[model samples]
Every structure is written in structure tokens, then in C-alpha cells.
Target: MRNNRPMSFPRQQARTRRFTIGVPRAFQISPDGRRVAFLRGRDGEDAAACLWIRDVDSGAEHVVADPRTVGAGEEDLPAEERARRERLRETGAGIVSYTVDDAFARAVFTLSGRLYAVDLDGGAAPWEVPAAVAPVVDPAISPRGTAAAYVSGGALHVVGLDGGGDRVLAEPEGPGTSWGLAEFIAAEEMSRFRGLWWAPDGSAVLAARVDDAPVARWTIADPASPEAAAQTVAYPAAGTPNAEVRLAVLDLDGDGVAEPRWIDWDREALPYLARAGWTGPAAGGPAGGAGSGARQDVVFTAQSRDQRTLRLFRADPRTCEVREVLAETDGTWVEIMPGVPAFTASGDLVWIGRGGDREGARRVLLVGGREAGPPEGAYLRGVADVDGERVLYSASPAGCPGDVELWLFDAHRGTSTPVRVPPPSPGGDAADGTGEDAGGVLSGRMRGGTLIVQRRDMDTDGVRTVVLRAADGGEPDGGTAAAAGGIESLAQVPDLPRPRVRFWSAGERGIPAALVLPSWYDADSGVRLPVLMDPYGGPHAQRVMRSRSAYLTSQWFADQGFAVLIADGRGTPGISVEWEQAVRGDLAEPVLEDQVAALHDAGKRFGFLDPDRVAVRGWSFGGYLAALAVLRRPEVFHAAVAGAPVTDWHLYDTHYTERYLGTPQQHADDYTRSSALESWGTVNRPLMLIHGLADDNVVFAHTQRLSSALLAAGRSHTVLPLSGITHMASEETTAENLLLLQVEFLHRSLGGAAGVQEAPKGAGGV
Candidate 1:
């Protein structure tokens, strides 16, 4: 239970970093199920995350490595590492991620650009890897556990676990060329974070070589620190030339030297390297072979620049031969999902496919493929793990868009069903054990017979994790009784008021929404409260979900005297393919229409919402939507706070923006129609634009251009420029005060009680 004490919501939100500072994540369950390793902060307020492992037998936890003890400071990150973390929106400190070997005996990670390895079985202190280069990034231990591969100085290097024979496997061929690293678009938009993948046998590696020479360069300078030189970045804006990405098969020998064999593919046609990985022996090729063995299959997925066609290919690393396995095409765009183009243990290809005649849902298809599950409303999100006979995945079933449940499909039995792992009750007992329903959004990973299940819902303050063993009857059997219990969460208790959330569907499209009323509000008092519509309302994200923590900020705003409504209409994920594609060709119209529809419908159902006093607030895509609401539909939205909004589609990236809006040259009108810059003249509300000057994703120029247009149109608006923030308002003081400022602005703009004092001196611009 949380401490029932008064605290500043904004301060707590900042201190705890939105309740994510100490949460355990990036879980890796050992194949033998004896141990589970994760990264978490030492305490809720602790920013530096440490690597910890839990013993499945005795339920004991061991701190494998602590940055504080290792003499590594989070502030010592390399420039490349800092940029990578920024792309990932990772704000935490210390060991944020690590990779283990196949046997789970060795784990390798880079802390402050120094490579370190820990002996999982020996309980020894982590030691630095002997590298020719001092700074390292993305250290991955080979599957056999004898060697590790990492990137340094834009080159890939490998070292033996015995601390000898460290050598550069691949070096840059040209000025802007780098090996074993994801390109900007691949990392920023495609969600394929890694640039290299190891072979199952550890004998070879499939690596990507990136050339950024053709991409346009943009300089970001710190205006406050005039003495520092500006940093230049390769930014591939819409319609601009992208980084040249290619894959190579690097064969390694015992001497730590690698010979690269370039894989042949039509780089001009399929330019985007969406995904690349190695599937185990089940993906058969040659039997009883050594180098390009029959057991290991090198697979990759590539998409055209327009993103309308995606092709999956399997390659022979020994010969650098490639064969297309599957190809998908759509007129609008083909979606690239995570954990797909995988092979089941028996050599069957597994992937997530768009809707077919059998069902109007995104489903798992086994290649030569047939739908693995029942053709219904179950929208497959991603594959978690694939064992010999079973595939584990996450999906949202019928009428449960807010809840994602773990499901398993037995390839042998041809049965797909939800995995019913018991959830922990408030008292920490099994929900079933206490005769209560375990209702929540569930996600899990399976290894051998062990399963690690994580559950989060509106009823809980934090995520609950449980480990279970599979029984012969195909049900969860409590493994070592003590170890089988819910894993103790070291996350800090957010001592904040519980959200009074009401989940419902609104509008004709059945847009999912959650309406949060003030805890002290009396429904029968006949007081119509002002409304605040908060929504991301875009593709790849959902604002309304089953997690309680997802509503914390919205609830805080509600407690500040407004009814907060979050909606996920068309273009938001977790519905059908059609729902997600609704915004294609024109990113603005349908999304804004859905938000408008959801607002009106929710106001009609929830009598306490005052439509005339409604305000909208958001960041990123939501920020764009907020600005759109006031500029184009001021009659519906009275005021807005748009933070880091995308003012023009041409300024965005190729992979993300081109997928929806097409090329600016080809579809000039579409970009013109979708951009907020074109509609600035219609603004008739108290609009405030907030942007971080250091943001590279949605650059500060977005806000600057919009503010300039508004000023030219003689429209009244405010622009708040954050001097040193990025896409994420991660700075503690800035994040806390930003929320307070938003509340103060809303209260003043919406005719409520004047709240906080004026904004800090230099925070505002015009």
C-alpha cells in the first residue's frame, strides 16, 4: 500500500519519473528456467539501473553488477551511446540493457561506453573486456558463451572470453561508413534497435554496414552554451536520400578474425532493412554442416522506400546466397511488426499478417502460411517466444482493446488459446487462490517449461511478475513454491491518489476511451466541469489502456478541476488493420475527426463534461492533434497546449512520414492539407506551443515555424522553448514545472481559478 500522505503531484511525478524509474524490465528467462535476469534501479528515486538476477529455486535475488560499485557514472556516456539512448527515449541511468549467452552463463553489457562481462554462474565481480578501443557500444555475447562482439569507433570488434585475441572484425571502408550499427531510420522508426545479430553456433555474425554520406546534415547547437561547438547529425527528412544500408555475413574463426561476404540483394528496390536475425536449426537448410549449417537460417525482412511492399528473405551465410521466403504488399503501406519472420522449432515460418477473407484481424500466419489462431477479433501484437511445438504471443481479443493477454498456439495440436497464468491479488496471493478474478493486461515470455508473466491493470499501482512451470495438463503448475510466487517489485510506491477511471467505447467507430473524474466530484451536484481531451490518437500508440499507471497524469489533471478524457480512435493500434490504416494518405483528417467524434459522444454520455469549456493537451503526435483541434476546430476545442508538435510532414523522417503521406513532391497537396502550418490562420483559441530546443526527432523548428506562421497571421499564442531538453522532457526540474505550467495555463485559459504563478522569466517566447 502507498503512503496516504499529501505530496506535490508534479514533484512526485518528476521524482519517480512517471513511476518508471525502478520498474524491472528487459527480462531474460534462462532456458533451464533456473534464473531470470532483469534491469532495475536500486530504489524508486534511484536513476541508475543495476543488473539483478533472481534464483528460481530459492527466490533469492543477486545484484550482478552495480554502476555505482563498478565506478562507472551515467554521465560518462559516449556521444554515439547518448544518441542511441535518445532515439530509444531511454532516460534511466546505469545498466539499461544487457545480453546473455545461450547457456545464460555469461552476460555482456556496455556501461558508460566500457564493455563489461559478468559470470552468471560464478558470482564474480564484473570485469572490463580487453578492447583495442576504449569506448564500446552494443556488446553482444555469442550464443556459445565463449566470445562477445561489440561496436567501437564505427567498427565491429570481437574478443574471446579468456581476455585475449581482441581484434576488429570489420572496419569503416569510407568516411561515413560504419559496420554493425542500425541506421538512423531503422532505429528511429523501424524499431529494429540492433545492427548486428550473432549466429546460433557463434561461428559467424550477420551485420549491417551503414553509409550515411548521402543523407543531409543538420547542426544542433546549444544556444545557452555559446562556447561549445554545434553537433552535426545525418537527418533523412521526407523525400530526402536515406542512409545506404547493406548486410554482410562475417565468418569468424578461432583466431578472432572475420572475413566478410556481402549478401546479394536489390538494395535499390528494397532499401529498408526492417528486420534481420538468425533462426535455430528448426529452419532447416543443409543437414550436418559446419559453417552455413542446415540448422541455422539467416533471415531478414526488407521494405521498399514507399513502404508498400515487404519481402522476407532467407540467406546462406557460407555462400551469400539469398532466397525470398514471403512477400506482402498493400496499396497504402505494409506494417512491420516485431518478432516475426521467425521460424518455429520444426522449420515452419511464423509471422504476423494483415487481415484476410477469413477474418478482419491482424493474425499469426505460419508460412506456406495458414492462420494459426481462430479468425476473430483477436489482433496479434507480437511474438514473445517460440519453442519446438509452441508459439507464445500477445494479443487483444474481442471487446478488449485496452487489455493485451498472453496466448499460446500449439503447432502440433493446432490449437491457439490464452495462457491463464494466475495474477497476484492486492495481498499478493494468487487471484484464483483468493477466489477473485485476475483481470489485467498480461504479457509473458517462455523458455523451456518456465514462464515469466507480467501483469498490469487499473487495480494495481505497479506491475506484478510471476514465474510458473508448465504441467502435463497444459496449465500453470506452481514451480518451487517460494520461487513461483509473484516476484517482489523493488519499484517505489507512488504515493498518489488512485485514479477514478471509467472505461467505455464512444462514437460510431467504437473508439476506446477512458474518462477520469475528479475524486471529489459529486455527479448529482449539477456542476458541469470543464473538459480536457487528452489523446495520442495516432498510429502505433494507444492512449486508453488497462494499465492504471497510464492514467496517472490524466487523473492528476482531473483532480485539478477538469474531467480528463483519453481516446483511441481510428489510426490507433490494438484494433484491426483497417482501423490502423484509416489515417493513411492523409495523416490529419481522420485522426482529428475521430477525436472530435469521441469527444462529442463522451460528453453526451458523461453529463458532467462541459463541451464549451473543453481544452486539449498533448505531446508529440498528441501535440500535433492538440494544435489541429484549435486551429481547424476551435468551436469544439477552446484552448490547447501543443508540445513538440509536427508542424509539417516534410520535416519528418522517411520511414514514418513517407509511409503515411507519400513523397512531398508527389503528394504536395496531401502534405499541405495535413500540416498544422497551413491552418495557422484559422486559430481562434488560447493556444500555447511548448518545444524542446534540443529535440532531434521532431525538431524545435516545428514549433518555431508554427509560431512564426501564427505571428504572421496575427494570432495570439504563446511559445515555451526548453533550452536543453529533447523529445522527452527528461530533465527533472523542467518536467515537474512543465506539468505545473500546463495546469496553470489550462486553468487560466478555461475560465477556472488562477493557479500557479506566471511562467519563469525566459520560459516563454512571444
Candidate 2:
């Protein structure tokens, strides 16, 4: 959420609203469709995460019992105690949230690596199922909703729905099961945290077992607690040994834990199982006719570390055998492409690929070398079949508006063919392309011989369940009216303005951003306005994608006539692993280059933008980016507002810092080049920095060093350390004041009409 908007913002046009804590997160629709489960957490110090379920139709809400019986974080404590706790939880609340309703809904939430289930019908408090010790994270229910599977305490597990029991099905063999190690290697390297999956019939679970026992663990003093003891976290820095990962399947039954069938791969090969799940049994059995026990094996992707090689492996659960049907490799890195389209009732596996010919080398590969596969002597981007024999898969590049494509693959022949799915009707900006925008999450199901694909269009802000009948075209399930309304309400957050996705090109990546234009904006009128470019430049930590920030802040920016931009540059998540890892050892270059490019691009494209009127801003890692953007590219930006930024990696906490930039001792040059404190003299742009004096994540020393270095370099900059403001703010006033100060900085430096604005009144928030 953008921090400051004037009263004229779009939200203000509707109504003035009271401040509220806790925006809903981890929203999960129940299997019965009668209820929606969500993780409800507080904001700032007043914030702590808790499980809460709501009646989808009635809007009734109930707080799921907390295992620690810690009532809503600060809400359960006294005033003085609340204030004290706020100080501790600001940097981060070590709380775990959940979403049940997958095939296995038995194990709902995870607490400190342990599994727990809450009654959907509202019975006793949450009960802990101690089958494992570590966090049973990212639990996936089977397609029939009988078993829930998760990665816990460095092992894969399955729990029965009818209160049968929980069992450890598979643990990384040999060196994979080291103590104090985080879960899978994919979760760390590829950043795919949910490391396991449930099959369609709940008969088997496909899991990614990562072995990182060889990687070294780094220690960092807890940033949230200076007087508190130091805490060590496992950090696999760049070029360091990463966890070796593999894919395995466990037999799921009411019987005891079945043996794990390892997918056949070279033992020396570090093959990453990026995606896995059963495609239901092969349609029509061996002869393409329906057969009860004739389900085809599950399909998974075996990728290499640099992400160069990809092999599609098909494994039969009954036989416990695996075979590589299709293989693709790249000298640089091959993108197996995450979030591929789902399969149809006809057993066609539609997915996106980047190599081959057909669409012409130039036309096929767009940003970051992405393109459709070779066509009839051509290529396709939206669809392709990795295992097709002749015409394995086809693609719809042009007609398919959204970034997602529809494909049909014949497993036996190993060929792919694209299916022409109708585009969303001409409405408010239809779903266009898969690139970085358009597609949110695609959920598909086969029913009554119809392959129904549920596409959530980020562009249209709508979700449609399209039904493709018998390989032929059919009407969408939700239809027009219901689909439109559901899409709107699903994204229509209460007391906030709808977010917009903005794009700009940086280096080889098409950097994407979410923008909230000022509510008072007049497009036709050439009114040069101030802008705030907020970014989070950490590796895989994308802040712009559907994130709920403090109290209607974007509305505040809109009201104030400041164009708020949240850019997910090269290193940000939601893109690819190569794009994310590229920032390693060169953190500031990719991010700084992108911010400058975006600022200039915005000015050139939008007539209302003031060429000289731009301010860069962010918090934590974002704050670090803001400091670097202005200092490194002072020509593009006028001012900067950095909140709790890590001025130098050498002095910051080791775990997170070293993970991206490596140890200061190992990559001394990169650490020095990426550090703002080392180049404080270049910070000639107008700078207004605010930080929590008690921030542990980014020690107050970061600000102190920046303040001192700027002074020594003879560079003038403003500094404000919010008293009692920990690294994070809980109360509304904290965010409000932050926005207020930020807007003031933008006004002074970006040529906001002098004397045109009055001082912001009232405390920042409640």
C-alpha cells in the first residue's frame, strides 16, 4: 500500500474510513465451499499472526485457537506489556499461518515445525499432531481431499483426514537429514517453499527432498533484540554449496507409511523438482478409453542448478517406477517456467517453453529470452508439450491475451498441440499476456468430460472458470455476471483503492511495478506532479505484488497528487530464478539501473509527470534500494526517503545479508561496491531518512553510519529516528507520519508548488 495520498484520492471519493488493524492474508477456500480459512495477523507491534476462519456466505468470523494460547499478540497483553511486545515483534513475528482444503485437509496449520488441525465446523481448540518436530510447512491436500501432505522437520509427511494418524513418509537420504537445517533445497535455491504435493486420488505424495548438510551455516545477532542473545540462521550464499534436491513419491493409505519410490536420476546430478503432481490416470486407459485403475503416472520437472537442463519424468505410483520422456537443456540456463497451465480431461499437459524455432527467433523470445517453442517449422510461447512425440504441443501466441496459454499434450505420442481458448469478453482491460502480468493463479479441474480451467486475470481483476468440453469449446462455469462480480470482490479490498500494475524495461528484464495514481489526477491537463518510486530490491522478496500496507497509504498518496510506484526490479521475486540470482554480488547495479530507467520512462510516457519531480522510497531492503537509487543515479531522481535501510552489509545481520551478497570477508569487492555507506559522498540528491531507533533487523547503526558518512562527505541529508518506532510500525500514526514526512520531502525536492500545501495535522494514526 502506498503511504500518502491527499483527500482527493479515489478512496476518499467514496468515503472516509476508520483505521483497522489486520488485513486478511493466506486466504483459503474450504473444500465444501461453505467457508474460507485465512491467516489473520495484526499490524506493526499490535500485530501477530493467528488462524481465523470466516463463513464465505455469511461473513461471520471466528479466531482459531492459538497453540501457545497467545491471544492476538499485543491485544492479549496489558498496555505497558503490549508496548513492550510491540518492540520485539516489529522486525518480524515468528508466527506460522495456514490454508487447508487441499486433498488433505486434516493437517491445517503449522506451529514451529509441528502440524496442527482446527475443526472446520467449530469444535475444540486447535489440536497439535506431533508426528514431526519441525514446521510442517506448505501442506497440500490430495485431489479427493482425503490426505494432507507437508514438509516437516526436514522430511515429507502425510496425515489422514478421518483422524487416522500422521506418518513420516520420506526424508532426504544419506547427508540430507542434518539437524538445524531448513527444509528443501528448492525452497532455498528456487524459492519454492512448498516442497511437496498430493496426487489426484490421494494415493501418493510427490515431494522435493533437499539435502544441504554440506552448506555452511552463518550466524547473525538478532536484529530485533540487541540486549537479547544472538540467533544463527542457515544461509547459502552465492557460489556456496547449495542443498542437493531430488523428487520422491510416498504411498498414501490408511495402512502404515509406505515405502518412498525415488524418481530415477543420476545420483551425482542435483536435479531440482520444481513442479510435480499426478495428471490423474491417462484418459481412456491404454486405448484412450476410460479405465478405472488405468491412471497414468505423475509428471515432474527435473532441472539443474543454473537452471540449464530440464527433464520431464513420468512415474507410476502403483509400480513405483520413473522414466524420462522429454529432455531440454541450455548452455546458459533453461527456464522450466513455473506456474505452467494445467492439464485437460483429454490428458493434454499445456505449458510454456523458451527454445526451438517456428515463431522466428526474434518474435519468439521476448524479454529475458522467453518465447513459445518451435512451430510447424515455427515456435510457440503460450503453449507447448515437453513430452510430445510428433506435434507434442501447440501454442496460441496472439489470440491468447493473458500471459497464460492453453495447450493439449499427448503423453503416448509425446507431442504438444495448442488449444484456442476464447479470450475474456471486451470488458475493463481483459486478460492479455503471461509475461509478468495478467495471470495470477490458474486452478483447473476436469468434470463430466469437460476440462475446466480457472484463470485469475490480474489485468482484468477478474477470475473466470472456463469449461472446455470434451476437447471442444464450452461455456465458462461462473459465466459473465458472477465471474465479473467475484473477480471484483475478491480483489476489492475494504478501505483501500484497487492497485495497478506498471511496467518498465531494465537491463534484460521487463521490470514490473504496481502504481497507484493520485486520486486528484487529471490526465489531459499537463500538471507536472510529484512521484514516489518505492521498491524492494532483495532477492525474491517482491513487495509490490498484492501486498497490503499500512492504512490506506496509497489513497493518501493519490489524494496528495503523488504518483506512487512499487517496482519489482531484476532481483525481486515473481520473475525467474536467473533474474533473481543475477543480483547476487551486484545488488545495487540491477536495482539502481531499473529505478532510474523507470523514472525516466514514466516522465517520457506520462505528460502529467514532472521530469524533475521524482522521489525514491522504500523500507528495510527497499529502504536500502532507495538510498542507492538516489545516490547512484542522482540525475534521474531528486529526493529519497529510506526507512530502516541497511547502509552496509558488513555491519548488518549475517543470515539475510550474507545470503544475497555473500560474506564481507569472502566477496569484499561486491560488498564494498554494493554498500551505500561506502559511497555516501555520491548521495548529492535531497535525502530524508527515517528509521526506528530500536530497529533490530536493520540496526540503528545503519542510520547512524549513513548520517555520519553523509556529514563527513559534506552531503546534506535529513534524518529522523522515530522514538519507540521499532523496525516496523504497529500504530496508524507511525505510518501516517512516515507518509507525511515522505510527501514533504517529495514536495520540497520535486518542485511541488511552494506554499501550495499545508502541514499535515493530527497524529499519524490511532
Candidate 3:
């Protein structure tokens, strides 16, 4: 039930943005694996997200596109599709994403900022392309499904699909330039949310221009609209000036607006482009220059603005030359690996590097550069799809760094395996009906031999999906294998209770922890309870994972009676690349010493934990490690809430604060040993801080410069702000009264074991 009164787990995890609205997510299969597509919500309180498809031999699930049947009700989007759905933390709302045609016979997307498309073999009704251009950001669909490429108002258009060729190809040559979107350090720290790509014979696109007039602007305001005007933002932060980003190609088999061909490099020594596209003509390499043999080439990867050199070029879209096939250096940075500059439909070169040295490094993958599978000591994580010579990826094994799984690989049998799911028919409890065990946290896709997958564990609560394939000509039913099924999750769930977590490998560098408790805690009733921790604990992300929606809001803060814990420790990630470069130059002491060593090793192996009623909460680098665990361990955290925190690593963002503190102008003591305003007059506990007066990623000037350095060191705390929030307090009554005012200020600053009660004064900020 989406809610029928009596639904509090912070209002069903903020009306399910956390349980992720109706769960089926961006799948997209169809290269002859009989159609698949995805995106969900016709339930689980449906906050928009429609698209659908599914028919692998009559499993039928259609609904092609329905932003309320294309009238696009009340979405008025476009500040570049609301900053590309706030840089893809995409809190759903109608077709959150799409883009299909590589003969997946058509699909596009975008609703409020226009453009629609739709035709995956027609059951029609999705028109509005009218040659796009009404704010359409990040479209794509052009493997010759006759033209699409998007991004408006900062130009790079190319329309054509029966709206009579709308063409602008690349505009914005001044005022914070732009051309094909994605800037703000390549979509918030290099996950590279595309600037544009297209050419496997859609005759060319490549893109990315970005300028942001040498960044650093900031502002935001609307502190409850004093007649509202503020906004500004170019931002960059930490050793400032970033948004220059270049790259080019253009041509769309041209007749007008064509002239681009740029693609140079050494952009002041690799200023983070981090990945671009095209190897097409089915990945068979070599072209455009050096004999212009042309089987499709472009490929990209840039990085090093002290991201310790990532480089992987190959370019040549008709002699805008490039070359460097592989580089990867590191003394401390280079991590940008997700799906990689891939290829392998026999054109080899599928890359992801760094193997053992700086504190035993190891993340291999590569396919033509060799060392295939995520073998020897696993932990890889990222690659998740190549699909012709296979690949797939995702990792976390060498001693289960919290179970992420998925595997596949193949490149013509240099083997890899581990994909699972096919179990249910003998008893029918899980090809989706939730018997889980494709182990925890998987994800997938694949083509022709089908696959799909999905998963999430701690024995499932939301996400399941499945699919599989290969059983069409009547297979030997218990021998030749292949034939799973199941995709139906309408998400909801967390009408709380049933979390009682535990997971282990806690202290002495085994770190990975979990804890959670209070599903009516009675660990043999020793009754101690009152700790909380809940870290994001830094580096990319992972808050103790083996999924059950990652402990539904840490078991709704352990059913609100404390004892939560969580942790990943040493600079996070699936536990490698030297455990995410151990916060390279200290983003605050080994992440507040592994959340104070997993809260004193879970208060010495669960003796019902109270560790002096600790408390720590987070958001963004776990709200800078819950305000650095009460300004650097207030005798191991007596209280803190911190949401949107980055209490100044020089106000964040420069390819993630210069890949772990390097440019706060040449590591001003690693930004003063990771500034929680260099321990602002040691505010002894009960912190608070909440920020987000429109955060453009950790902005609100980092909780107004740590609440003006804790009121100029007179130290007391508690701030809140919020007006027009971002940095995902995904709204809904400020994510349900910021979890009921941080468990009523951790039970009024841990004075009484927060046995939770008082939570109604002005709720939580706007």
C-alpha cells in the first residue's frame, strides 16, 4: 500500500524516492533479444516514470510511454531538465530516462522539456518531437533511427525524425558556453553523464563544449524568498576555476551548421573529460585518420587535473587527431571506471586498469589490454555492460566487500561467468517472487542470449526483475538451461520493521560493518542501545550494502530507538584500489577512524552497544563524516545530524575535491586536515547543521562556512536552512521532517537514550 494512514518510516522513506519509485529501472535490451525496455511506476505511489515493454516470447508488459498519457501533467521542467534530474540522482517523475534505437526500433523520452519519440514496433501514442527544441536535454536515439541528439539552450541540436530536420548542431559560443551539456565537473565529479555522442553512421556528433567561464560564482539564496532572486552558481570550488572541458566532431552528414571537427586534448593537461563515445561499425576499430581506414573510432577518456592521469584517447573523427590508446598513471587518483571506453564485439580494447603497487592496488578488467575477468582478489565494481562480446562486470568478492556480484565477461571465451537467477520453477518463490540469491546487489543487461537480472538482497524487499532467455525451441527442461522470468516490483515495502541487520567484519581493518538492531531488540535483553553512526564514510559510495534497500533508512534509524552503526571504513568503494585511495591525503583521519572503529567494534561485539550514547548522521560524504564525528571525535560522537555537509574541504567539487584533497591550492595541509573548519573550537557534540538552501552540490556555502566557523568559535550548533532544497533532501516534507528531526535531535542530544518521542516543533526546515 503506498500508504493508507499509519505509514511512517519517514513518510514511507520520503514517499518512496528511497525505495525508488516502482522499481524497474533503465534496462534497455532489444538487439534481437526480443524487446525489453524499462522505467516504472504505475504503482508504489507512482511519481511518474512510465516507459515499459518486456515481451520476450509473450510475457507481454507494454505501456510504452505515459507521462500521464503524454499530456505531461504539472512537470514544467527545464533548467536543463532540472539540472539533468539533479545530475541523475533522478528522483523519478515520468520517463526518467530513455533513448533506444540501435534497431530497438525507436524510443526517445523527456516529457516536460518536450521531445517524446516512441515506436518500439508500435502500439503508438508518443509523438511530440516536432523536431525537438523546447528545452530537451540529454536525448540520443540515433543509430540511424534517423536522427535525435539533444541538449537545448546551450545548443547542439540535430532533430530530424519526421519533424522536418530541425538542425542546430552546436551553438553557445559565449557566456558560460555549453554546446552539449554535462559540465560541473562532468556531471558532478566525473560519472560523465554524457555531453553527446551518436555516430555509428548517424554520420557524427561527439560533442562536449562546456566553458562555465572559468567557474567560481556561487550564490543560491531563497532563504524563504525575500522576494526571491539569488540563484547564480558556476561553482567549481576547492582550488577553483574548472569548467573548461572541450572536445568536438559535429558533422551530421551536413548541409548547414557543420564546422566542428575539434577533439584535441592536453586541455591544460587532461582537464577531466573522462569518457566519450563511438567505436561503432560494431566495434571494429581503426579509422578517420592514419590511412583513414574507417571502421569507426573516436573513443575517449581524459582526466588528470591531478586526477593522477587517466588518458585513453584514440580519436580521429576525420583527423581532429588524438591517439594515446592507454595511460592510467596514479600516485593517488585515477578512478573513473564504469563501463569503460569499451568495445569487444571483437574490436577488443575494453579497458579498466591499475594493478598492484600503491598500497597494493588492484582493479583490472581490460579485455584487449588483457587480464580479463574480475579474478584474482575481485573487488572491481563497474563495467556493467558491453553486450556483444559480453563483459557485464560489477564486483565485490575477494572476501565479500558487502556483496555486489554480477560477472559475465567472455570476449570470445577468455571466460568469466557468475550470473545466476534461474531458480524458481521448482517451488516458485523467486524468479522474482523474492527468494533472492543471485546473491546481493546485482544488476545486469546483455543482448541476444538475453539476461536482464536486477536483484538486491538482505533477502529482498524491493527490486528483483530476472528474465534470462534461451528456451525458445523447446529446450531439454532441466539440462540445456536458460528460461527464467519475473519482473514486477511496484516497490513500496518499508512499512517498517524487519531490518534487525548485523553483518560483520567490523574492526582491525576488516571494517565493512553493519549493526542496525531494534527490530524490537532483545539480543537476549542486555538492553543497552543508544549508538547510531550511519556513515556514507566516503569515496564514491556504499553504506554497508548487501541490500534490503540498504537497511531501509538504517532500519528507520533502528526503529527510532538508536543502535544503527553502518560503515564501510577506509575510504570506501567495493574495498580496493587501495580501498579507494584511503582518502588520498586525509579527508579527515581515515574516515573518522572507521567511524571510530565501527563504534568501538560494535561496542565490543554487540554487548547491546550504548557506547556512551553516540550519534552521527550524514549526507554528502556522510555529512562530512557526521560533522567529523562531532568535530573530530567528541569522545566518540555524542551527537550530530549534518545532512548536506562538506563542512569545508574548501567547499568541495573539483573532480571530487581534487581527487582527495590536492588542490585547496596545493593541499593547504590537505585543506587543513579536512576542515570541519579545522575542528571549529571543538564544539563538543550536539551538532545539527542541516544545509541546502538550494545546494548546488554541497553548497549553502558548506553550512554557511560551518555556521560561520561555529559562531566564530564560541561553538554551539544547530542550523537547518533548506529553502528550495537540492543535494537530494528529495523533498516530501523535507525527507519526512529530516527523519523526524534527526530522531528528535538524537533523543535531545543523547541525554536520555533517545527512546524517541518529541518531534513536532516546526517540523524540519523548508
Worst 10 residues of 1 by lDDT: 282-291
lDDT tens digits by residue: candidate 2, 1-766: 1123344223332321222223344444443344555543433122345666555334466766454472222322222222223332422232344545442133365444455666656676766554544445545555554556666445566766556677777654664462112243443344344455555555666665566676666544534456865533334544555556556666765465557677766645634555555665221111111112447476766666545577766677667677776666655445544344334345454445544342232112221122224333232432221221111232223322113344544343333344333465455322322112333434333222233344544443324433333212322222221111111111223333444344444323466655666444556766666677777767635555432332146545554657777666677644443555567677788778777666666666766766666777788888898888778777777788898888877665433455466666677898888888765434488888888865544667788898998888788889987765566654455654566667766777776732224213211211
- Model 1: CA > 4 A from native: 1-6, 254-257, 281-294, 358-361, 425-438, 471-483, 680-683, 753-766
Expressed as tens digits, the lDDT of each residue in 317-397 for candidate 1 is: 787789998798888788887767666656777787765663353556453276786337677788777655667778887
Which candidate leads in lDDT? 1
Instruction: Give the TM-score (vs. native) of candidate 3.
Output: 0.33
* Candidate numbers sorted by TM-score from highest down: 1, 2, 3
Candidate 3 residue lDDT tens string, 1-766: 2443456667767887787888888887776777788888888878897888888777778787788878557988878788777877888887788877777888887778888787876567778877545777778878767668887788888887766678887788778897877886777776677788777777888888888887878788876878878879788887878888788888866466778889888788887787777777321111111111347768887877888888888877898778888788887777887777777666777777877666677888877787876878888877766766767777878888878777777766687767656555543324432233545887776766677777778765777777776455431111233655677777777776667787888777898888887665566766677888888888878878888888887776776677788888888788777777877888888888877877888888878777788888888888878887788778778888888888777777777777888887676887888888885434467788887787788777778888887788777889988888888888788889888787777778887654334222111111
TM-score of 2: 0.61
Comparing 1 and 3 on lDDT, the stronger one: 1
Q: Point out the higher-scoring one by TM-score: 2 or 3.
A: 2
- How many clashing pairs per prediction, in order? 3, 67, 5
